[model samples]
Target: MHVYYYDENFMYMGEDIISEYDEMPENATDVRPKKGLYLPEYDADKREWFESASEEYIESLQPKPQPAADVTMLKKQVAMLTHQVAQLQRGGTS
Candidate 1:
């Protein structure tokens, strides 16, 4: 059997395989979320999974924006210094 876990706010925690004879956890259910376009939430009253739009979840899935252009020169300088240090450690002329 499979058990779906949820937090107090009914947010999804995760899921796990459980023995059919095992007792269900208080915050767990037998319901499984259907594969969908949006995240799913367990509706205890309906005993089913309902799709819910989650901005936080959607944002987290997205790639973070790159660092500002102003930092690029500093990063390049740091990299060059690091490479020089590595060469010095290897007894190679920088």
Candidate 2:
């Protein structure tokens, strides 16, 4: 069982081996905009995306994590507090 993805040029992207058939979108087209055509291969008994291909494709398809403004603000605050703590520690020692 193997899954294959190819670009418009028909170049192989990769392959996966799975055990069941994952339903594709009704509008699924062989042409992937940035990616390419995706094909799934499965064992005769199991009709799914190839395990390797499914895992890799699924992982690749995930959206990248976005940085949060609050997280950035918190980091800045932490840095400021650290500097203030360092200054206080120095003054207390002096």
Candidate 3:
């Protein structure tokens, strides 16, 4: 069965399996809401916060945008090739 955990102040931490956790942390306690209890504002706030946080986390997991290739490196390679071609035209002597 799944169990929800909370901090000492009754702030919800998260849910996990009691078998998996085995022992709760010193500063944490098991939390079980009363049957039929409902808090619309708290539910909405938590849902919104979780949605935003999930989006941000997913974005962070994505590959970052790479920077463009260096123009200076391309220029140097072009210069080297041009010199090599010129030598080839002049009877292959570098």
Candidate 4:
């Protein structure tokens, strides 16, 4: 059977599968939680799974957008490449 685990604060930790005949660990339970934005936490009083999303956690999952490249820098690189190719065609050093 698959068992889910929680920390002392009831935050979901992870899961493990064990033989049905074996004794379940103190921290483990057979209650499979629904997948959440983050793992769902167990509420002992409610006796059911509850989930919540953290703004910080959601922000962390998003990648920061990269800054746009300047056209001037690209133009310089192209010019340099053109000069090098001109020298290469004439059997000169790069």
lDDT leader: 1
- Residue ranges of candidate 3 with Cα displaced over 4 Å: 1-69
TM-score of each: 0.54, 0.31, 0.27, 0.55
lDDT of all predictions? 0.85, 0.51, 0.52, 0.80
Residue 84 lDDT, candidate 1, scale 0-100: 93
Model 3, 1-94: lDDT tens digits are: 4665555444456666666547655533334444432221113223221122355666777798654566678888999999999999998875
Per-residue lDDT value at 16 in model 3: 68
Worst 10 residues of 1 by lDDT: 33-42
| Tens digits of per-residue lDDT for model 1, 1-94 | 9999988877778899999899999999998877863666888999988767777887788898877885898899999999999999999984
Over 1-94, each residue of candidate 4 has an lDDT whose tens digit, in order, gives 9988988878789899899999998776788887653657787777667765678887887897655566678788999999999999999984
Can you rank all candidates by TM-score, best first?
4, 1, 2, 3
Q: What count of clashes does model 1 give?
A: 0
Off by over 4 Å in 4: 68-94
Where in model 1 is the C-alpha error above 4 Å? 54-94
